[model samples]
Every structure is written in structure tokens, then in C-alpha cells.
Target: MRRYGPALLLVLVGAAILRISAFSALYLRYVQAGLRPYLIVSGAALVLLGIAMAVVRRSADDAHDDDGDPLDHEHGHAHHGPRVAWLLTLPALALLLFPPPALGSYSAEREAAQRAAQGVGVFPALPAGDPVELGVGEFSSRAIYDSGRSLKGRTVRMTGFVTHGDDGTWYVTRLLVSCCAADAGTSKAEIRGADALPADTWITVTGTWHPKGKLGTDAAWPPVLDATSVERVEQPADPYEKR
Candidate 1:
């Protein structure tokens, strides 16, 4: 434990900083209301645990002896003195200072390729509604598997950031990531009558699924959703899907 004292201290400080940042209203509200308390408590616990571990390890190390045996001497030195483990926190600290933007062009292309190969027939049909919340990741995966068969001719309402095109049309897109934004895939349905769409504006769209064209290069996966109406909406604090 003493060998990892610096690492433990770094962990404690990192946890504290992250928690404080998250607790700030502007940042907290942008993430999600439901998750705020959980994050706060968990972060606090992590900080406290790290501190306690470091202290206990230091205390134990102070009571140990410097033996002449090579292995013992090495172990004692490694555990009883300052170590390099704390360096592991550098990248994390950098990230906290400069959070990356949402997954963009690269993710979009990857998602398009994935949809192309798998197809979009399996997506569940959207029930008729003025504002239905559709999970972008779920919908994309289902479409790839089932080709939007379940969503045939049904209207769906979805909310997401707007991605604009040069042709005056805009898409309400969300990234479906496997782990983080770095590996996320993008998915979107067309929004007609959305000529005035604003980039990055969280909006709710109501539309019906219409088999218009093929998804990607494959004729097997067909396009779905022709939006009837679009309205800007608030961004959820926790933007990521729960599952």
C-alpha cells in the first residue's frame, strides 16, 4: 500500500475535483438531474476511500524495517517511499481541464458504415405521438438487425442535436457509442420542413416512418422517417443512454 501512496493521493484529489465540477449547477444541469446525487456521493466516497487507503498504507510502512535481503530491501523501498504511480493521473487531469466535444464526423461515418452492412429492418416501429422519445442507439442497432420492419408506417418523436447539410436539410443526430465519444457511432433520420434547423440545438421531432430509399450503399436497408414537425427543446443533463 505504501508503494501506491502517491497513486492513492492522486486518485483522491482527482475524485474531489471531478465531484466539485459536477456539483456546479451549470455543469450538473447539462449532464442530468437524476444522476447528480449519485455522482456526488460516489465521487465523495472514492475520494475518501483513496485518502484512507493512502493514510493506512503510510502508517504501516512507517512501522516496517529496511532489511539487507535484496528483495525485501526493494519491496521496502518501493512501498515505503515516494513512487511514480501518481503519474497515472496526468491524462485524467488534462481531460478534466479540457473536455472533448461530442463525437462528430468520424463517428458519423463509422455509424453509416455499420448501418450499411447490417441493415435497418429490425428497428421497432414508432407508435403515433406528438413527441416520442426514441433511443438512438437502440433504434440504430434494431434498424441494422431488422431493417425498420417494426417501425413501418408509424410516427416517432425524438430529441437530439441538429446536424445540418449543405442542401438546406437538417438531421437530428445522436452518437451511439460503445464506450466513450471516441468510439461512438452517429445515427439520424431526416427532418423535412426543418429548413430553419439550428446546429447543436436540442430539438424534438415528430414524424412517420416512410420507406423512401436505401440505407447507405445497400438496397437491403431502407430509409425511415419523414418528419412532419420540428421544435427546439432543452438538452437533458445526462445525454448518454442508460443502458
Candidate 2:
């Protein structure tokens, strides 16, 4: 068993990857959808390599046994692998049995300062509607930089996990990722008129924009929403927005 440790570890990690990427949509928690095919291929390759290694090792052991001298038979085959190497499997097992939840309020809060947009400019007109659905990142962009005030009178709906601030302040927050969770950045809107929800709770907020400070300034950051309704909802399949 000890001799097969490396193969076991490989198989376990590969299976965990397959469990998240091929068997379900859980990969979205950590990476973009475009990466699914690569993950699936990687997982399959690991599994195959592990099986090949195990088979080759087993065959070698059998051949060694068949030609062994009487003196050699009296002694046992020694496994020199370090016992600490088994610890490496823990993370694979954890991923297989209990995959971590998507990044939430804690991750959002870690970004103490927000990055500013390029510059204030006119954004394309939004489609004609009463309550337009918007992404938290897009909303933040328009609120902070759009000279056109595209959101001024429109009722908009945005969904994200709730995050609380210092004071009694709370926000509907979304993490934007370019490639994966490691590069995730936070985008959020301060909610007014609605009661704060528990941290990490998913919610759909309907509100109108509440402009702040001059556009293109730090003061306008985070933006503001005068929420008319706050409805708890399940987290989306793909939680992070494209940066």
C-alpha cells in the first residue's frame, strides 16, 4: 500500500477534479466556464497516468517475486516513501467529499480599497424597460463613471450575496474574476431603505440609483441604491461576474 501512495494521490486528486468539473458545475466556484474543458482533460490525464503507474508497479513486483532467490524471499521488500507524503492527500479528499463554497463576504471584505474605472464616459443606452436586470459590476461602473446617467430614473434589479460594513451599512456584493477565484475583485452597491441581511445570504435587490459625489471620484465609489424590495434567493450557478 505504501508503494502505491503516489498513484493513490494522483487518482484522488484527479477524481476530485472530475467531481467538480465533469460531474457538476461546481468548478464555477473557482474558475470561469471557459476553463471547464481544460479541467476535464487534465483530470482524465491524471487518472490515466495514476492507473498506468499502478499497473506498471504491480507488474514489476510480480516479476521480482517470480525470480527472487531463497535468501531474498526471506527478507521483505522495503518501501522508502516518507510517511508524511500521505498528508498530501488530505486536500484532494476534502475537495471530493466537501468542496469549498464560492468566495463570499469575507473575500469581498479583504479588498480594502476598490480599483477605479478608466475614466468617466458615455456608456451605450440600456434596453427600454421599467426594471432592468443588471450585473453588480456593470451597475457599479455606470454609477461611478457614466456621464450619461443611464440609471437615473430606471428601476433596476441586481442579485448578489449580502455583505455588511462598519456602521449599520450593508451591501449587495459580487466578486468579478478575469480567470479564476485567485484573481477575484469585489464590486458592490450600498443599499438604502432596506434592512440588512445576514452575511453571505444571496439576495435580489430592486432599486433605483441614488447618485453620490461627483462622477469619477473616490466619493462616488460603491455607488448607492435606494432599494424598494429585497428578496432572499439561492446563490447562482455561476457566482462571479466577468471582469
Candidate 3:
């Protein structure tokens, strides 16, 4: 049985990878799409390794059984290690049972003081359109520091989960990730006349950006949106914004 220990771990780990990547957006919540292929390959490799280990163990057992020595059974040629190795499966099981959700309002609140340092390039010119669709992170980033003040006249649309502040303020918040959730940063904009939606509810607010104070200030500064309309919306498949 001890020989099977490595096999058990491989199978469990592999199953966990496949389980999460196959059906759930678990990978997306933590990492980017480029990792999905690697995850699948790793899972398949682990399962194959486990199966190979089991086959070798069975062959060894059969070889031992073929020996004419009856004492072979009592001699205990098998080495089934301690049960503690089973703990490895807990994470896999949890990934299956609970499936952790993406960072939400609580996370945004905790990171309120930290804003995205200058994102990828000069904020790209708003693509030609009325009520341009914009990511929460982009809106927040530009609002705070873009010298051009691009959002001033644009009727922009941003989608994210709602969050309530300690001061009874509402914000549309989204996390920005350079690579994965491990490196996640937060972006947010204060909302006015939000229709008082419950916190953590997903919504798309279409409106215009109005300057509050100086752009690009300290943590106290945030992009403000005077929402012309607020409505509950479904959560998008990929929720995080790429910074």
C-alpha cells in the first residue's frame, strides 16, 4: 500500500485539476486562459502516473503471491504508509465541493488604499462609440490619473459587483490582474444614485464620469460616476480585468 501512496496523490491532484478546469471557472478565477492547457496536461499526466504506479504495485503483489513460501503473507512485504498522506486529497475535495469564488467587495474594500500603478500603455483612445463599454479597472485608472481626462465627456459603461462603503457609499468594483489572482489589484469608482442595490450584486451602470476633485491624488480620490441608469446584470464568465 505504501507504494500506492504516490499513485494516490497523483490521482487526487490530477482529478482536482481536471475537475476544476473541466467544469468550473476555477482556473479563470485564479489564472489566465493560457494556463488551462497546462492544467489539463498535468491532470492527465498525474492520472497516468497514478495508474502506472498501481499497475506496478499489483504486478509486484502478484509476483510475491507466486512464491511458494506461505510466510510471505505474514512477512508483510507491503508497505502501506501512514494514513496522513490522505490529507492531500482535502484540497481537491474542497475545490470540488465549495469552489472558491473570485475576489469580491470585501477584497476590494481591503485593497481600497492600493490602486493600479500605471496600467499597460497610454490608456488607448476610447474606441469610436456612444456610451463606450469600459472595464472598471480602466475607468478607475484613467479617472484617477489620465492627464487627458478622457472620461470627462464619454458616456461610459462599466460592469462589476456592487460594494458598500462604511460611509454608506456605493461603488462598482473590479479587480485588475497582471497575470493571476495572486497578483490581483483592485479598481473602483464611486457611484451616485445607484438605486440602492444590495452589496455584491452584479450590475452594469451606464452613465457619465464627473470629476470630483483633482485627478490623480491620494487614496482618498476615486472616479465618480453619476449613474443615469442602474440595473442588475448577470455575472460575466470572466470577471477580472486585465491591467
Pick the lDDT winner. Answer: 2
- Choose 2 or 3, whichever is better by lDDT: 2
Best of the candidates, TM-score: 2
TM-scores across all candidates? Answer: 0.57, 0.96, 0.89
lDDT at residue 84 of model 1 (Cα atoms)? 61
Q: lDDT tens string, model 2, 1-243?
A: 887888999999999999999999999999999999999999999999999989988987787789777656445466547899999999999999999999999999989765844788999999898799999999999999999999999999999999999988999999999999999999999999988999999999999999999999889987999999999999999999999
Task: List the candidate numbers ranked by TM-score, top first.
Answer: 2, 3, 1
CA lDDT, every prediction?
A: 0.57, 0.93, 0.80
Q: Which stretches of candidate 1 lie above 4 Å from their native place?
A: 1-9, 12-112, 119-132, 137-153, 166-168, 214-224
lDDT of 1 by residue, 2-80 (tens): 4665656556555655644564543332343465566666667667777777777666556555334666656666635
From the highest lDDT down, the ranking of the candidates is 2, 3, 1
Where does candidate 2 have its weakest 10-residue lDDT segment? 71-80
Clashes of 2: 0
Clashes of each: 19, 0, 3
